[model samples]
Target: MLFVSTMFESHYIGRFAPSPSGELHFGSLIAALGSYLQARARRGIWRVRIEDIDPPREVPGAANAILRQLEHYGLHWDGDVLWQSQRHEAYREALAWLHEHNLSYYCTCTRARIQSVGGIYDGHCRRLHQHADNAAVRLRQQHPVVSFYDNLRGEIHADERLAREDFIIHRRDGLFAYNLAVVVDDHFQGITEIVRGADLIEPTVRQISLYQQFGWQTPDYVHLPLARNAQGDKLSKQNHAPALPEGDPRPVIIEALRFLHQPDIGAWQDLSVAELLRRAIDNWSLEHVAENPSFSNALR
Candidate 1:
């Protein structure tokens, strides 16, 4: 139960959190650009967070590469970059609070059993009083949120079974689960809005449920349309999507602007990256962005 008295919910505070799985690609650029413009358009604060918790998936020097890529595209963020790896103490303290309050329990449910039960976890272990030895921890879903509102798409809902399940907060492999860490970090960072890709929309309700459990404010969410390739697969590092070019960000920036359905101003070719960013920020509008997934030759 990590609670905060101060509310940043009144003002605009946005963040772009990227995992160090690999360098920034075209799809990731859309997220960064959209979040940056959304914050700057209101003269609000924009922050960056390095989500490097999953060491198995992280690449060497990928974090630095991401920062460099952002700089190359003139997507400057405000304040210090918060690293998830350094926040283990905070996560520990939160888990401790939940345990003390009887709001969480340990479970040793296997993946095969979960799949046998149709993949959504049941509360079978909630009343079993399972031991903590080599077990994962799950939060007691006191108030499951089935639906939430999106800034881009309205009135979003989650699967009923998923919303009602006792979701994991700590993994059996001795790492904090993403749902728990993300909610805790967002609260710690005082984020008032979350702007990311549409692929993440399904987790919004789970995150909101966690916020409710913590008695903290839930931030606004804006899930930008995903970028797809010619074959219709969403551009992703897993798909070995090509990384953004290091030289000359001008063309890609213009293409990204076009992908978002923003006005090009007919002089993007003559403007420097910084000036183009300035113009784009001034003209950025969430309403103007496309609702469908964007497909283009833009470096993803």
Candidate 2:
């Protein structure tokens, strides 16, 4: 088993990567606040990455809007924002390396075909020797990852079949897969920790597998509880969740802190955002965060 150290080191680098498909909503704020607080608490670098690889789904000015929202909430990140759209060459290089090592193969199976097989890929094209034309590239799951450790959630085990499936690295539409791009970017950024929502817990195993394949160090993970609506649905762009308020981010910030189960800071209501953040960083504790899937009263 590959052991990941949770001890704070000088190379502690964390990131908050958000897709530019929509504006920053409350759910997005929870993730951003958790990541920012975790990085600041550990005296690590907090970086932001714009996941704009999917051009068709991206909004025209969502990326800039996200940055402005973060600024408004005083969630300033370190260094220049890394845009995934600009890192295509790096992903291409990584894919080429996998192919060169015979760790990847061209897959011609369509979504319908996969659905016919109960939705899990059965390595249909592993030995088909299919050409790359009109085919997606899949990583051969030689050492399948079944489970991984989360700093906050303990040991998380994934579905056995899904863990061992030959998943796509490059889509048939010539776009990079989220799993592939995230793994490549995380490794490239030298990320020491990943602090995001609990909804992403399942993907941790796959990412660890990718790290091992590339002979890279895997980072520690902390999956924060997701903020959900009263109807038990996660607050997301698809759900038409309202975006963060444009001005006076104090209320939202306090609400987010309360959602995380942090100590009450009503006294800091009149303080500046910077001061509140400083207090938050000093008082942040992963142990205080709830482990449930959703916080029902998060928005209240």
Candidate 3:
């Protein structure tokens, strides 16, 4: 289904939802600066959301350190931070809505079973109506999104087979999956614009479908290119990307701004944190940003 809604009024609400898997790295900074600058460029409200729903994957004290690093780098977010872990009730409500409307089902398929078949999940349990207590909550693909238009990247499409697959909403272990949580959270916050990493482009289709299922408005999406490592792997916690330095954060912040295509405040290497951000905010521009990935090892 390809239903297009009018733009999200560029009243511009942008956000950076970082997982507390480890400390913020170069990739994290790129996404942060990109979203922040884009929001500032439109005179929008930039918010911070901590995606910490999976307790086992979260590193102790990592969330606090992330907030500290953002502060040190002068990425001031509006409003209090929203934590996914604290919003289980909201997730529960979403799940219940799906269940009542026959939009969701319980699946007992194990990872091995799905892998043996293929990475794509076949709707093995869609007709069973299995009890929710002993299975994972899966979103039935009632209206799969085959294509959609991205603000930065034109007309995007997903693999038809994968797009039609029934993806999990709540894991068998009982935690809300990322797709479900992110979609619900965005709606809860009344997010108007989503400016984040380009890697998320593929997932936007499914998330948009969920929005349609729930009769909620889909926000405008702008996916910025990723930060790559020396080997060209995406800079991520899984790749052992180094954490941001706790010392003076100006140079790194400047690099992030430049990477985002925002104007450079010359020789900001010696400027105070406040002054650096002042120049950055004054000169922010999404048009200057590169549409391709920026490789770096500074934030390793």
- Judging by lDDT, tell me the better candidate of 1 and 3: 1
Instruction: Write model 1 residue lDDT over 196-251, tens digit each, in one string.
Output: 98888777788899888777878998888888898888899999999999989999
lDDT of 1 at 114: 95
Model 2 TM-score on a 0 to 1 scale: 0.94
Q: Which stretches of model 1 miss by more than 4 angstroms?
A: 1-9, 290-300
TM-scores across all candidates?
Answer: 0.95, 0.94, 0.91
Residue range 1-300, candidate 3, lDDT tens digits: 122223244467889999999999988998998788778867888889999999999999999999998998889999899999899988888898888888999999899999988878888888986886869998989899887776766677777877788888999998889999999888877688898887787788889999999998888887777877889888999999999888878878877776676766887877888877777878976656643445221111
* Reference-based TM-score, model 3: 0.91
Task: Tell me the whole-model lDDT of each prediction, alpha carbons only.
Answer: 0.87, 0.88, 0.83
| lDDT of model 2 at position 47 | 90
Which of the numbered candidates is closest to the native, going by highest TM-score?
A: 1
Ranking by TM-score: 1, 2, 3
lDDT of 3: 0.83
* lDDT score, candidate 1: 0.87
* lDDT score, candidate 1, position 102: 89
lDDT of 2 by residue, 150-245 (tens): 787677778888889999999999999999999888877778999998778777778899989988878898888888898989899999999999
